[model samples]
Target: MPTILTFGDSNTHGTQPMRSRSSDLPRHARRWPVILGEELGWDVVEEGLPGRTFAFPDAEMGPHMDGRIGLFIALESHGPIDALTLMLGTNDLKAQFGASPGEIAQAAGFHLDVALSDEMQDRHGGFEPFLILPPKPFAAGCLAEIYEGAAEKAQAVQDAIRAQADARDVAVFDANSVVSVSDIDGVHLDTSSHETLGRAVAEFIVAEIVEA
Candidate 1:
């Protein structure tokens, strides 16, 4: 079966909104990654870390937040992947991080470069890369203070990511186009949103992978 390796933050990790950080939604069936796998009848390896960022580290959240390092490790362990899907950058908008969207995109580009390098391709026997623009953040209630300017940052990052995808000639999917942030926490997806994202992304992967 074709195998896909998915990398990103909490959304990719299938965190349940309004729940504690230690909690997670049932990833085997509910998360978009598994849903996509079911739709395509393919294998998916989920590698999502809450608070993950391509540019910065959350000292409070631990070193695992650095997605670049995590990607390196994942590529080493999950070599011979058929495809990769990435959805990151929201955590970079944290107030303490102080990263501009352009910088975030640049950091993400670094990870993409590493993932698509000739060395990685040789290890994976070749694979396609897909960039998924995370949903725009909703800065209200619990997220208002820490996630200030999150909507704007998401927009900026989305534009930058699209440009990068075009330049690299990789597939790009706008998560915002198919799903919206949950009103409960303002950052995570609701069950319905997850369903929507899964269906849309499954269709995208089908066209890109099977049809191509």
Candidate 2:
């Protein structure tokens, strides 16, 4: 069976304001890997930390620290990761460098490459990795301030992620493109939104991992 690892924040964790069935947000499963595993028949592992990002911020539970922390955990863990999906930037935008979304995404991808390289090896002990990009933040009311305009910010980040993916020769899925946000917070995925994300991700994994 293929083993996929997902690391991100609340979105990957399926966190909502209230408890609801996984079906509500089929994609954002407070335990999304579990739902995806059931749907795709793949062994999914989640290492999502709330309020974390791929880059560390300057505050406690800040983006900068949490970002690197997730990478370290993924690297140190024992498992041959067939695929890795990352959903970050929400907290990074909320905490620091709101307008530098492109730069933040570039830095995040760089660190992810480092962690994957350290963890995986080719026949000659080289790095092999798979990566996915989270969709742009849902900009509604308060979300706009948080994301500094999620549409533009998300586009910048997406461009950066694509560049890195092309350079690394890894598969890329644009989650931001697949799902639409419906919350005032702009960061959290609602039930319907989460389900949409899960379905899109599951389809990507099924096509990339199973069919391949």
lDDT, each prediction:
0.83, 0.63
lDDT of 1 by residue, 175-210 (tens): 988898887677888777877898899899888866
> What TM-score should be assigned to candidate 2?
0.77
Pairs that collide in candidate 1 are none
Worst lDDT 10-window in candidate 2:
17-26
Best by lDDT: 1
lDDT digits (tens) for residues 96-121 of candidate 2 = 45547567767767765764564354
For each candidate, what TM-score against the reference? Answer: 0.93, 0.77
